[model samples]
Target: MAECDAEWELCKENIQPLRQGRSVSALHQALCQQQEGNHTALNQQKQSVHQTSRLYFTFESELRLYDGDDPLDVWVRCGLLG
Candidate 1:
C-alpha cells in the first residue's frame, strides 16, 4: 500500500512540472493542453477500470461455477478486482 501511494505521488510530481508553465502564453497553452489531455486520460482510465472490473467479475463467477474452494481465492479475486 505504501508502495502504491509512493508511485501515485511520483506520477503526480511528474505531471506537476508540466502543469506549471514557464511563461504566460506557454502557461495558457499548457493549461489548455493539460485540460484536454486530462479529459482523454480520464476517459481512458475509466474505461480501463471498467473493463478490468468486468474481467475480474467474470473470472470470479467462472471460478465459483467450477466450485473449486481455496482460501487464497478471495485474495486473488480482490487483487484482480482492484
Candidate 2:
C-alpha cells in the first residue's frame, strides 16, 4: 500500500489538476491494471468511460434549468429528499 501510494504520488506529478481532485484508489487500480499487460484493451475501456462521462456532463449542462429566483431551493429540495 505504501509502494502504491508512492507510485501514485509520482504519477500525479505529471497530471493537471481537475475541478475535483483525482482519486488515489483509482490511481492504484489503474496502475495495477496497467501491469496486467492488456494496454490496448484497457486504453479503449478508459477512453469509452471518459467519452461517456464527457457526453453526460455536456448534456446535463445544456439541459439544466434555473428559475434564478432562489438558489437555495436546491438545498431545500435535497434536505426534503434526505
Q: Which candidate is the best by lDDT?
A: 1
lDDT for model 1 comes to 0.77
Predicted candidate 1 versus true structure: per-residue lDDT over 1-82, tens digit per residue: 9999988877774444646566788779989999999999999999999999897888777666665567567557656434
Provide the overall lDDT of each model, using Cα atoms, as 2-decimal numbers.
0.77, 0.72
lDDT of 2 by residue, 1-82 (tens): 9999998888775667788888999999999888876878888899999988886676555446646677655545534323
Superposition-based RMSD of candidate 2 using all C-alpha atoms, in angstroms: 17.0
In model 2, what lDDT does residue 47 have? Answer: 100
CA error at residue 62 for candidate 2, angstroms: 0.5
- Write down the TM-score of every candidate: 0.45, 0.34
